[model samples]
Target: MYYGWNIVGVGMVFQAISFGFTIYIFTFWAEAWMTEFNVGRTQITATFMIFNVAMGLVSPIAGRILDAFSIRVLIISGATCLTVGFLLISFANAMWQIITVYATLISVGSVLAGPLAAQTLAAKWFSARRGLAIGWGSTGTSIGGLLMPPFAIYLLLNLGWRQAHQVIAFLIVLIIVPLVWKIIRNTPQEKGVEPEAPARFEPTQESGGQAVQWTTIKVLRSRNFWIPIIAFLPALAAFSTVQANLSLITADIGISQQKTALLMSIIAGSMIVGKLFFGGMADRWDQRLLYWIAASIMGFGILLLMSQPNYTLMVFISVLLGLAAGGFLPLLGAIVGGRFGPEAFGQVFGLLGPFLTLSAFAPMLGGWLRDTTGSYDSIFQIILVALIPAMVSMAFMKRQAPATQASG
Candidate 1:
């Protein structure tokens, strides 16, 4: 067993905690916040926009730091911010305080500790099995999604939302800080092992050599960079819209809170299968084809949602949605890693962050549309239409090529 697997395990745990406690469990908390603050759904959803925008704004800097500095130090700093931010949120007396904490510490911390860091680490450690490695590591988010919402609801029911935040903070301190310090290494060379590829180890301009460091301007100008960003944006926007509003959507349709949580877990459970399946296949299949499949499934799921199906039908829809959602992260990681090489992985991924902030608005839009139309149907229809361009643009995404070397 290679030491890189250990790094993957740590990343899995990191994503589970970061995404589970914050993104997956947020809607549950949103319900409580609405009652406590006397605010509307759109206002609560704005926290997600602020959090996402903050993460996007900080990602490029974080990416450069990851490439040039120590990942262990960066992760530890992020853990500190995440723990402290959650602790502060427990004491927030006003909506502005929650917004401020989310926009600053929480958002910044998530970028440092979340998928960007985890996928970069995986990309660095494995060459041949990059997709599988990323898929396995990214499963932590689905696992977190599967488990966190129910646990959060239990805590929300028993301890109140404030105490729940405190518990989440404690878990972060107990789990992420020590594991990252003890287990994570920057690359395979640091652990005295070769990357999982043929043993030739000969340096080349294309294979296992010093990768060309892409400048920010060059990365932005490349069609390779922009194509994936454009291809995946709508799917991501739709997923974010659904996750952020799942609770309210269920309530609007008169589903019980318990069942709603179960639905969320079902979506997450299905995602685990999707991630493993799509991830393992990415190494062998055309990545663009896999993405189109996932996008199509997602579109069909959204179409089902517009029909206002019964609970049984909704369960079926959740499975479709989960499978599609599950495929996105691993594919994105694999695509970026494949195209850019590990040396430029962090920087390229970081530069791509702000564009993802666009997805954050999907939730706000969902909330506004629901509030204005008194139905979620319009948002679902809009998301379904959004998928058309995503799939079509994906057709134009060229296959991966050797990373271009930077000029002196």
Candidate 2:
């Protein structure tokens, strides 16, 4: 039991660092990249769009690799690619160079071993505790969000964005590679253990075949598979937009960059708390209720963000929004595992990846809207509208048994 949590913990750390750089820090880096590369804000934000396109386009390939390769191999490869992408971005001169390194390479690295890989690994290790386990692994993301922004801000100030990239490159090489190589196992049976559960939710396959035999095509046909992806679309849009634009949004209201970074750090910090509390809540409460309540909080927070432009309000709204948005990360995974069971979690979850990644377009859209219309108010209103559908969809999730209940 202890070892299982340890395994999940290590995987979560790997996820935290990898995704922190990929999604969260890109906002901080965007302003610096604009200055360094002599590009406009839109141009720099465009790079993030490429990153999204890459993640959406390449997820199936990532799924295939996850199914085919050892988790360690994929993780190490991902870490290496991530490290190199950061280094390459540090030295990039032309727009295409930035696109190649930051957009294409880093996107591939993240999808290869991002949250999907980590949570799926944790899912295999615990049957009855699957929601809690996936929730715990997902918290690593919030932890990274909490921790990375301040670090990135400080690093950018002290070392320049280029050197910060180098620092991250070195860290990934030193940390993730060795830990993943040592800690992750492909499956429990490999360690001379029986299945975590025998005929608990679903029977152990005759020969321990791939988790889901259904192809991506087959999985796409199932509403249960697609509904969460659709429902999550607005949340991802809100997250992606806010991540890229929050600092700029605050700056427009006369808040300094340093204060903006601090506000983001506070928001990210709240996310860590939110993840832990909500994750525990998943164990005890109906996930559907928790999701609706969380979404409502986020929607209101975004509405608050739209209304206020001052430092005081930014700080207050930041923490509130953080807590509201943070729970969705783990809750989405729990919903997936609960709805589908773990028999083919890797594939089903992978199928959901592209849609989630594509939702990141919200930020790029926000940036373009800001560039065009000169305010973030409209984007927030659109997000408020978008979120209503998402909350309603949560109610539509079939009243099927939670996966844990099925096993019980």
Candidate 3:
């Protein structure tokens, strides 16, 4: 078997630990923080905003480091930061300490070890199979989501939140640090293997024969760079809004806490299916069409939420949202790789990081809308309207040429 598959496997594990701890298990931790700190919902939401903003600010630097440095070094450093940050969080006595840690260490760690790194690794190792490779790797996030919450809840119940953080920190040391150190290589060439697609040795005008190095100014000036970002922003924002507020949203509709937890698992489970299915399709299908399909599903899902459906109907709605959310990361990675090419993949992806800060506001906005209007209906409506321009922008995006296709 090719070592690239090993890279993908390690990437999957990296995503599982990074996203499981940072994203999936966040709401559970937030609940504990609220009780421990005696804070309001909005205050809890602010920490999440801080986490994202910090990640956004650091992403470009992380991306450049991924491009220029060893993947092993970056990932191991991130794991150490996460282990230390979580351990510190367990000892935090005030909300300020939690905010500071989240904004600094956790935020930086997540960028280095999370989706951006995993996707960039896949991009480096596979060209023709980039979508499928990324699809498989990105599944770590959904898998983490499916497994971590129940485990964390159990820890939070039996041991206490502090001990739970300690256990998670220990697991990172045992798992992520060793796996990345042993298996990850900066590129396929490092393993004495060729990438899945034909290697480009001749310089093109766009990229000078070496790895395409995109300057910040060049990336910012390109319309191709911004099109996918604009097209997917709304869907990402909606997913963030739902993930951050799902607990509160379900409680408002009279769903039990247990059922809300199950809904999160359902979303995660369905995301696995979405990532694999849409990921395979991206290599064969028009990516813009896939975006349209995802956007439509997202719109319908939000409409279902507006109705405040019962738990039974909410299960179905969760599948719709999960499938759409699942497709977002892999598709975006494939699109970025397709447009920018593997040579410049890291810088381009990193450059795109700041745009993520826009989605960071979705959670805060959702919370504010709920507090002001006494319901989440207005936010759902706003998200639905936001999808219109995304879909339209996707329509205008130029299709990838045969040579530049991910399959190529």
Candidate 4:
């Protein structure tokens, strides 16, 4: 068995536990914590806003730190913060404490073990199969989404949100920290394993004859850097808004809360297929085409939900949107890895952190539009329109080659 594939396997576990206990479980905790803290609707939702902001703001720093330090260091530190954050949040006396601790510690922890770190780890192990490895690792998000919510809800119902968090923290400390320490190697070279290609040993040259290793300034100045940042920004905003308002919009359409919850499960289930299909196909097909197609499909799903309003189309919409949602990050990572090579992937991908700020605000905009117009119609229309430019970006964006390759 390839050691790289082992990293991919362990990475999947870490990602699953990381996302499950933190972000995915937050959905369940939101109302529970709100009631306990006596927070208003806006204040309770602000925790997510804070979380997104923290995740986004800390992203590049996490990337740079990961590049500078050993992978184990970041993983351990992140896990520690997450564990502490969870433990502390469980005992929090005020809403501000939850907001403050989560805003700082959990956000940092998430960046350390979240999608970027997982993809960066997987990216280090394989080049020929980078997409698949990333895709495989990414299925953790779906897996977590599929399993964790129900479990979290059960805990919330039976033991309470605080106790539920303590339980999750215990499992994370017992399970996640050790797996990361034992199984995750920063790069294959730690085990004397060679990469899939030769250039990983030497800096690859970009089109302008610049070394393609990491430098914050060089990446910030590149077209590839900006394209993905810009591309993912609105797409994520729309997606974030959709997920944030999933229950409200469904209720407005007269779908029962039970049905909406089931549909969310369907959406979660579909992500596995979406991630596997898009992730696997990327290695064999045109990634750009897949990226655009997924986004376009998302537009269709958004339209279908708003237009139909009935639960009849709910399952199909969930499936389509689920696939699109699942495929998104894998595609984004694949596109980055392909265009820029793997050397600076963390840095390049880290640049995407700031856009998450927009993602946090997107739901607010959607809600405002919904309230103002007395329907989600405008929100749907705006999101659909947002996809058009995003598709154009993928269609027109070039896979930047190393300068030597460019000259040839």
Candidate 5:
């Protein structure tokens, strides 16, 4: 296999391993923790809040660190912390113990090993195929989403939740941790290799050897940056609200838990296809047009989700939403990378993550609305209304043509 492809493959594995423990498997533990620990849903969700905090806060710092330090150290350290955190969680008997293990330790570990590292690494390695490489590497999320839920459910059935964590920890330590420590490297320069390829757009350096750097402040000040936020915010609300309530929504319309789970699997499986196919297609498409199309598909998916919530409808909506969910991440990254260049990517994108993460609160808020209003219809309508602004805003995010540089 080509070295670049190898890197992407390993990166995908690492992401799967990391996210499996952090998210997909955690849902399996939700019932166990509440049953055993006598905790509430809010308490269980608090762990996810801690995760968001750590990930959002660490992103900018991790970006700079990737520039300054070797990726091997970051990857290994992250894997170790995540694995150890899960193992420690297996021994948890108290609320504080769960909080420490799930919220604090795993939270910290996930930040170091997440999308920022994988995307940044891919950014450094590939120039011409940057979008495709980044997309492939980042597909770890979809893979983890597909595999971990069923695997977790199986482990929960057979060995119990705690034991599942222990097993997952062991696998991570034995496989991903060691492989990363041995194989993952920082850059071609660090490996004593000459640059064998050039980018489509090379840096315009000054006489004093400074490449033009786009500061986080400068990027934030640009209209292009904020315009996309409008699309992202409502899209976040729509997608997350549906995901959080999908099983419930289906069950309300009389589907059994078994069939609901199967439908969820259908969504996850479709994501694998969406991630690979759409990710590759992104590199060749007009990014602005692509964003609009993706957003439109997402909106359509939400509309479908709101329709019947029957078995057939559930399958169709799941496939549609799965395509949206799988495609959004890499496409968003490409929009940034193509517009801003890799040098400024970390800071610009880092700043954007918190707003997106805030979408988690949308589901929580939607739940509150459901309780007070006694129906999910209003919330779904609100989400649909929000998409209009998102579409309009996305249309405004095109890159400005650069001004000519004069000779000194």
Candidate 6:
């Protein structure tokens, strides 16, 4: 029995809550806030952009900071922020106030408490089984996303958005904080255990099959470094834009909000399958190839998701998208951890924040296209166009060579 599994359980629970409250839950309120504030669609979209920007700016720094201390401290602190942020937003009367809370506290706090931490925790504790560990851990996001929305929507209906925010905040403080304190330890050595495979040095060739140390500077300079970043950017952009607006999109197309909410859950439920399936399989399969194939499938899903997808058709598309998104976290985590080792994972992953957050603007773009063209058809077309190069970028990514191998 390993203590790391306990950490993963805590991470799964907390990350699920984090993703649920931070971004997915917010979608339910977008229209409510817009109507209350008397703002337009673009204005509503900007808040999410601010959230992404804030997470982008803060995550890398938070990652570095997490590397310096015990994870429990960060999770507790993050839970506090989330609680207080929700408390404050409950009383907010203006759009700017809501945006400020989301950007400054909720988004940053989410990075501290969510999948980033879970992934890092998994990376730290496991080496040979890193992908599977992270995959199970990353399921929190999808599970949270799956379970939270319908419940949140119910809350939104019965409790009202303001009170709903308060309830959400209180739940985070009550549920997540104690769990973090009880289960999470920074490394396995705290419990007198060691990582399964500290380093894999069997390969002489520079393929992605080793655990080698990498500095942030060296990583930024490598072609392989940008592979995941550039390769996945479009998918992430599409994901960011679609998830944030899926509720509104469904409403626009004459679907019931209840049904639309179910669609959100369907996407999330499918993600659990993808993450779990890919996570376990990554150990035995080529994670890189799996990701490339998944990304291609997601592109096709986006093509099928137009302004007026039939509910039946929408359900199928959601599954494809969910599986794609689900597979991404573990594959990316495994690839990075597999190539770079865990020592610099926090720092290396932090550097990815800016590029990753860059897609946050995709929602903003969708808003702009909506306002201009009166529909999301153009945005979907733009996403399809962008996926072309995203897939192409993976071709140039090479496995990193260890320092001694390079010197020889």
| Model 2 vs. true fold: TM | 0.88
CA lDDT, every model vs. true structure:
0.85, 0.76, 0.85, 0.79, 0.74, 0.81
Error of 6 at 237 (Å): 1.1
TM-score against truth, every candidate: 0.92, 0.88, 0.94, 0.94, 0.91, 0.90
Q: What is the lDDT of residue 231 in candidate 3?
A: 85
Tens-digit lDDT track for model 6 on 1-408? Answer: 667888888999999898887777776798898889898866676787788889888887887877778889899999999999999999998998988898888987899998888888998898667778989999998888777877898999999999999899999999998889887888888767765754343222335444444656777886666888988888888887788778768877788978977887788889899999888777667666777788888888888887478888889988998889888888888777766667666777777888888888887788778879989889889888988888887767664334334432
Q: Which runs of model 5 end up more than 4 angstroms from their true locations?
A: 193-196, 199-210, 400-408
Model 3, 1-408: lDDT tens per residue? Answer: 878999888888888898898877877777788889999866777888888889988988988888888978999899999999999999999999999999998998898998889888998888777888889999998888877777888989999999999999999878999899888998878877766754222111232224445687877887878987888888899998998888889999999988987898899998999999888778778889888998899899999998869999999999999999999888888888777777677888888889967898988889889999999999888899989998999877766643422332
Across residues 1-408, which tens digit of lDDT does each residue of candidate 4 receive? 778888877777877888888777787777777778788778777887888888988988887777667887688788788888999999998999999988998999888877888898877788778888888989987788878888988888899888887988888778777888888877888768776653222225655677656567877776777776666676777667778899998888788889988888888888888888888877777778888778877888888877755786888888888888888888888887777667677877787788646768889888889889988889778878877887777756775343354332
Q: Write the per-residue lDDT of candidate 1 for residues 181-299, one digit (tens) a residue.
A: 99988998887787777211211245554545578887887777988888888899888788778878888888997898788888999999889888888887988999999999999
Write the number of the candidate with greater TM-score, choosing between 4 and 6: 4
Candidate 4: residue 34 Cα off by (Å): 2.7
Measured on C-alpha atoms, candidate 4 has an lDDT of: 0.79
How do all the candidates rank in terms of lDDT, highest first? 1, 3, 6, 4, 2, 5
Clashing pairs in 1: none
User: What digit string (tens of lDDT, one per residue) describes model 5 on residues 1-408?
Assistant: 346676777888888878866766666778889999999988887776666666766666666776568787988888888888988989888767888665566876776777777777776666657778877877897788778888878888999988988998888878887788766766666665553354454332334555657776777787767876777788867877877776667766889889878877777777666667666766677667766776788888877766766678778888888877777777777776666666666666777776677777777777778778866777888888988888888767765333234456
Tell me how many clashing residue pairs each candidate has. Answer: 0, 2, 1, 2, 0, 0
Candidate 2, residues 195-218: lDDT per residue as tens digits?
455213432232233344565676
Which has the better TM-score: candidate 2, or candidate 4? Answer: 4
In TM-score terms, candidate 1 sits at 0.92
Model 3 lDDT, full chain set: 0.85
RMSD of each: 3.4, 3.6, 2.9, 2.7, 3.0, 3.6
